[model samples]
Target: MKSLLDLLKTKGPRDAREGAESNLFTTAFASKLAQGQSAVPWEARAVEVAATRLPKSRGTRLLQSVWAQDPYMSHLSSDRVDRMQRFFAFATISPNRDLIRQDEYGSFMIVLLSGTIGVDRRQPWGEHLRLAETRPGDILGEMSLLDSGIRFSTCTTLTDCEVAVLSAEAMDEMMEHDAPLAASLVALLARKLSLRLRVVSSRLSDNPHG
Candidate 1:
């Protein structure tokens, strides 16, 4: 089970981007700018144009914010913060309703930036069972990112929503460059996972059927 970084490294340089599970930048309008495609979505077009002007440091900042907000970030040293500031890439996703499905590759760390999303498990009886509502600042998709596992459940937006995505490679880079930050991040991830497990356990105790 190779991590996303290992998978990316194995690709030919030209094919790196193509290997991504989702085109975080591909919006409705990028086709219009293509050689023969028409009517590219403006939002997609804007991301393309913005990509050229934004500096790498700015991208790093966006990712740092996600890391800092994690309860685990409290353990990080200032030096680690500086190192994190040095590396990392950021991308945003604004998916339409029910756009992302279950059992997909859990490739990135997603921070809910806005709106609401429902986390649910499909059951033998029906779908939409064991649902949890998530709001801004909530971190999702981490279970799979920290471990090479498929998505544990489905996440569907209740309204148009935004998510900040940071690749595993970027996270690995942060760890290599800043030991404290890496430790802090791992601890943060652990804490979040532990909390989530407790929540699940409590629910099960209340109603094992769930």
Candidate 2:
């Protein structure tokens, strides 16, 4: 599968942006996976067992809130909703701890349930470029699922953070059996990309001289 970056490089900026916008809600990639095409190779890393689990009631409430706010989960059937609620594992990260490292292969993405995270890029000289600050309800590490399974930037918790971790394997399994679930995942990723594009546009507009 071609990475979005690779596809963008083949077109002019305007055309690339247009192409991305047009492809946002398409599930062609997921469809290909369903047909038994080669899956993107994600590097396996030791999984960290969650040290804590939310009480069932509290966890269900949290999942309900996420479903209400997230556009991607808006139209899901009750069965899919129940499945998602059970699929995630809660995780907590200490302040200044890295949640994701640039260039590392990742098999899971995180949905911030609370607190903030700083997204950064390492410069060639080893300095960090702070890209954005992500807050509650934001999704992180999704690029790993869509592209090469490699993370493009580092993410660190700015404050102690609580996140819901969803693995790619679980998602693949859901996609293979549930078409609605697959479409919802694609929509969620599309929404994340759209938000990022808007941010980039805003930055460019504010710094027209650059």
Best by lDDT: 2
Q: Point out where model 1 deviates above 4 Å.
A: 1-92, 95-100
CA shift of 52, model 2, Å: 3.9
lDDT of 2 by residue, 37-137 (tens): 53332222213322245454555556566666766655655566666666566656567777777876656677777789999876666666677898777
Model 1 TM-score on a 0 to 1 scale: 0.58
Which stretches in model 2 have alpha-carbon errors above 4 Å? 1-51, 55-57, 70-80, 201-210
State TM-scores per candidate: 0.58, 0.65
* lDDT tens per residue, model 1, 41-147: 22343364342223455544544565566666545554565565544333343444442346654345556655687887776556456458886667777775566
In candidate 1, residue 112 scores what lDDT? 64
